[model samples]
Target chain A: MVKSRRTKAGDIGIAAICLLLMIICLLPMLNVLARSLSSSQAIIRNEVLLWPKGWNLEAYKFVLTDSKYTWSLAWTAILTVICTFVSMVMTTLCAYPLIYRDLKGRRLFNTLILFTMYFNAGTIPHYLLYKDLGLLNHPLVLIIPNSLSVFYMIIMRTFFYSIPDSLRESAEIDGAGPIRILFSIYLPLSKPVLATLSLFYAVGRWNGFSDALMYMNNRTYHPIQLLLYNILNAITSIEIQTQEGFASAPGLSDTIQAATVMFATVPILLVYPWLQKYFISGATLGALKD
Target chain B: MKRSSAINRKRIANYLRKYWTLYLMLSIPLAYFVVFRYIPMTYVQIAFKKYSIVKSPWEMPWADNNGFEYFIKAFRNLDFLYALRNTLLLNFLDLVLGFPAPIILALLLNELPFPRFKRLTQSVAYLPHFLSWIIIAGLAKQLFAPTNGMINIALNRLGFESVPFLNDPVHWVFTYVFLGIWRNVGWNTIIYLAALTNINPELYEASAIDGANRWQNIRYITLPGLRPTIITLLILALGQILSSEFDRPFALTNPLVNSVSQVISIFVYRYGIRGLQFSLTTAVGLFQSLICVIFLMAANALAKRFGERGIW
Candidate 1:
């Protein structure tokens, strides 16, 4: 009975700490949601907290109605789809060959691929290479240059290695080629890793801005992230100029800024919860450290 | 023996012919790595060259080698030094404060008796990990703005000064590290929690039967079990002391705080993209990679010495 009471007290203490941390994570974001929904005057007066002071959907309407925001959103969606498709194809092709121990020059390929994780020629040379390839100012600049992540390839390779070789050997004996076996056998069973890597590539391409900032000079081709980056910079610079803060910038209000940020973030965040189980499995498996 | 070796070679050739499709599949990604990843590595020599736009960096010019001029310029620049200092300081703070955070969180969470409540807390905590740095930086500015941020409002309500959490240089580091911890602690804990499950529950039962208190049980069983994982992760963190997250620093920084917020990766980006000082930035990039390689080797050696898994 004494032990049970002590355990109960301990559980309560643990629960309280966890609850506090969760609140710390939730309150700031919830406050952003509240502020985005609140009136401009309420926001300027700092009246909003966890709840909106004067309920309104003006911010959402402005963000949704803005042609630039809508265009950038569409551009990001298109870029993400193409980039994810290309990345998955390249990653699987690279990963599958490495799974075979008898493959010619396997060691050389492994060393070359792994060398990139340790060293790169940095931004300038990367820019030069993309320019040489005529990738600048083109949508291919975003999609092609970063189509294959070596780390994701390594993870997929590991997943493929986990599959039994007997399956491949039996299929090979039945006169099935490597491509046929990959499409019909391996890929169907490797859905978890495929889904995880596809999501990783999609989310990565969606959130990416550095490459766009460097390679893309055309604002029309700018992803939503780069657009949001410019907008945020404009907002902050304006705030710096005016000590009287939290006011609207031209047609961009505090609520609109909040709304756009939420808009830029919510699509991927929505996908996260549904796919979270794979996230943990992917991370832990990929980070197994040999 | 020679005849058997010849047979082995013939068998290997036959195997390759049979699996030719695999090699065909490998060709596209190999071409990508060669053109995109490997080609730039050859261009690192531009750091040592005085090549301009008229003469492409790939051209192996015979004249004006300009040996180490860009390196000398980069080292002599004040902005480079400031960026270096900021990178070191922020990374050290992250190592000290942020490294052990997930471990502590995992420990606290492992103590929870109710599985449902534990899971709810985990889901909420992990939400921040998925939010991009752009969104986080925006949320951060909103939370810490001097005029009417919620933090400042709370300070005012209590009759305290409204600290410029993001604006002030002194407070910015604290805010930055705090947000880093908040963004990552939950996701980081997943590894530690996985490590925790590997601990033998039977040992805990035996210790309890021997009248060990909760603290003693944790100290004896939990800490030791977690030590290898802690060491391995510590080595990995140490390896990344130089290449801090580029997006966070880039998005969060403004001119007011750029002095303290500039980091090496951002330095590379600013110079390479905006300034177009290609040679100097590549020199700095080389320097950063060199130091990181050294640090990685040293950390791996240290981990191996301590009987933990080294990254290699």
Candidate 2:
């Protein structure tokens, strides 16, 4: 029996609430998109809402043509790729070995790595360490220092633990060494986790700004997000050098700001579908059990 | 004895022969942890010393007040204390206002009559979580700016005064918390949704047979199912009482909101990075880290004393 049949009023209320939430999240983005497509004059006059008025592609053109914007995008992309690769390798190296029960010092290794997740030396010491190691203003500072995340490593390890030990044991019986077993068996089988983690690392590296902000003063080393931050904040210190790079390189920079925001964001938005597919399960699995 | 020693040596050799590649693979990461993670811990000594860029932290003279000078100074400084309070306040606001949004969203989602619409809503909801703070904050500048922003422009058209949704101190707090909730609430629902699935449907069936209403079923069954998760997450959140992401506020905050936005992380960035107050900044950083640890342990202990399975 349908003892608790929902009323029409309650259903409408729920639907309305859900729609409101969706709108709240979507409106800002749509507003930005509309503003970017609209004329700068329309934006200044507040004529544009969620739809464009006197639409033009000038903001996009300006963003694309600016060498400063182009270079920051290029560096961010490069950083994303390199950090993703290095992080995956390092995460794998830290994770894969821990799956074996017989691996010596596995407990100690696990403790040392996992402890840093909860607590660390915090910002200044890490900064001083970077300084001591000559990493200030260095590109490798981003790539190398944070190459491995213990949390992702644990997820990979958990996935590895789920695979049947008999498969590995059979390989060992056939004389497949540890490295060989990993290459032939684990690597090929664990594609989903690997992909999810790669997206995490890539997005992380792409959006990284505080590191570049703190460590990098060299304009050449700044990522897209850092450049976006500077532009949004309108740091007057670099206005002369970067005026052309900001908001269509001209007057009424709001439209150009929206366009620049779009330019900085669309890269991640492109890869987001792939991320959404794997991240839900990967995150739940990590969160619920462990 | 000689024969026994030879046998032990042979066993060690055999073990190495079998596991040499594993050891080789482990060495690089082990070295990485030691250098990148652990070495920084040793540098916390800078907080205790009169450190300068001219000399290594190791060679710095002991700070006046017998290595407690910087810590005392940080504690004494009103600016430092203000930032510390602001850090906790902001995080508390996020914890109070931002944490429950996901749970409510998940519950409403469960109540939805249609799966397709629910799925679409969820996908859209998850979209903002993926965008960086820079992107979100950038959008806010356009959408919420006092004079030229679309919202304010609409308010003016409606004959209402424009609101400083972002550029003002008090209004910025609301916007900050709102954006923080908007960004993470949907994504956070994943765990609760997963937990919801694990709630046995048979209980709902039995309750239905007993003529329970939808509200009763949810109040009795669904909520109890979600209790452990909520508590665990809350405890974990409490452990992070002093820590805030430098990005969220830093990205959104303007000069006008400095009174509220001068959090501990931003404070460190300014002093250590811009002002080059190496010793003082390190002391502050160390203080924040230690408090985080203490809060985590205390939260975990409190949870366990109350008979919840805390994240040990």
Candidate 3:
């Protein structure tokens, strides 16, 4: 009975520690939400903590209605969808050929794929190549340049390789071509991997900023991340000006910045839980491969 | 003999014809690599040249006969050394402090009896990984504000002095490392937790039969089981020694703390993206990539020697 009580106490201690760590992990995000909703004056007075003070939607109103933020959101969504689809299709197609058991020069092809993972041609040549290809500022530049991630392709290839050879042999005997076998047999069996890859590609494209920043010079083509970057830059500049006493208002800058951050992050955070299972599974697939 | 040779060539041609569609499918990725990855490597020569936008990357005049001139210039730049130091320091601290955090968290979570609470905590902890650096940085600014920040308020309530969390260079590394742990620990923990589940339950049962306490079970069974994973992760982290967290510092850094906050990637951006010094930026990028390649290869070799699975 004494031992049981001690064990119970240990469990409680462990639970408490876990709870506290979770809170610490969540504190920054909660703080952002609190700061966004709190009145600028209340925030400046340091009244906000776990909850908002003088609860206001003014910040959200400004961010949502703001043309720049909304337009960038639309662009990011469009780019993410298009890029994810392109990546999935290309990766699937690329893996299909490599997965064929009887394909000649398979080893050489696999090595060629893996080579890109180890060595890259640097940035300038890529830029020049894009310029020469007339892909500059084109939406396709974002999708095409990064359509095939070799690491992901390899994972999908491994998944395909796990399918029994008899299945393909039977399909071939039934007069189904390679394309039909891929669509009818391999794809259905590969749903988990495809789902995982799709989520990975989607999240990557959604968060992608550097590509837009580099290739898309036109502001119209800017994704949400680049927009957020510019917004942060503007906020920093405002802070610098305020320090120099050029701007009289202080609270407004902080509120706007907080709001912009919330706007940039909240949508992604909302969709994250939906993709969490896939991402966790996908991350482990590499470790699981013997 | 000529007839046999011609027949052999015909057989090879027939084989190629049979797999024509497969080759066509393979061509797309190959084309992409050529255009996107391989061709870009040709431009690395610009590092030795006074590359002009008007002139071609190849046609540009060499700075000197020696290929090391730009490298020397990069080393001479005060910011380069500072950036390199800061990058290495941050990566080292992260590997030291941030590496074990997720594994511990995963183990603790694995011990939880309440499934609902476990799921909730896992979801909440992992939420930060999805947030863009812009948002994380913005949140950091609010929490770490010297006077009116929530952290300062809490400190004041506890009768401690309000710390200049963001501004002070001394605290920069700690803040960066801590923030990294907060944002990434959950995501990292998921991998270990997955590995832990693969641990057979019979071992635990056998340990229990032997009267092994929880601590002993964890030490003898769990730690030993997790060694390979821990080593693999360590090697992966070492491979990324030069690539510091870009978004975190980019967002968190201000003029006051730029010295400690600046990293090689940020440095490249400052010169390459913002300044449009394409040639120099490419040079810096090449330099970083080369270091990363060397470190990655070295770590892989070391991992192989240590009998751990390395990412080859």
- Candidate 3 share of real interface contacts: 0.62
Ranking by DockQ: 2, 1, 3
DockQ in order:
0.69, 0.77, 0.57
Cand. 1 Cα-lDDT: 0.84
lDDT of 1 by residue, B44-72 (tens): 88888775777767674532435788887
lDDT of 3 by residue, A158-218 (tens): 7898899899989877977778888899999988888889987887787777777777878
What local lDDT does model 2 show for residue A255?
74
Candidate 2: tens digits of C-alpha lDDT, residues A4-91: 3355577778989999999998899899999999997887777899999998998788778878889889888888898999999999
| DockQ-better candidate, 1 vs 2 | 2
Best by DockQ: 2
TM-score of model 1 relative to the true fold? 0.94
Rank candidates by TM-score, best first: 2, 1, 3
Q: What tens-digit string does per-residue lDDT give for candidate 1 at A171-226?
A: 98899988888998889988888888988899888888888888888988988987
Q: Which clashing pairs does model 1 show?
A: none
Global lDDT scores for all candidate models:
0.84, 0.86, 0.79
DockQ of 2: 0.77
User: Which residue segments of model 3 deviate by more than 4 Å?
Assistant: A1-4, A131-134, A236-251, B1-14, B276-279
- Using TM-score as the yardstick, the better of models 2 and 3 is 2
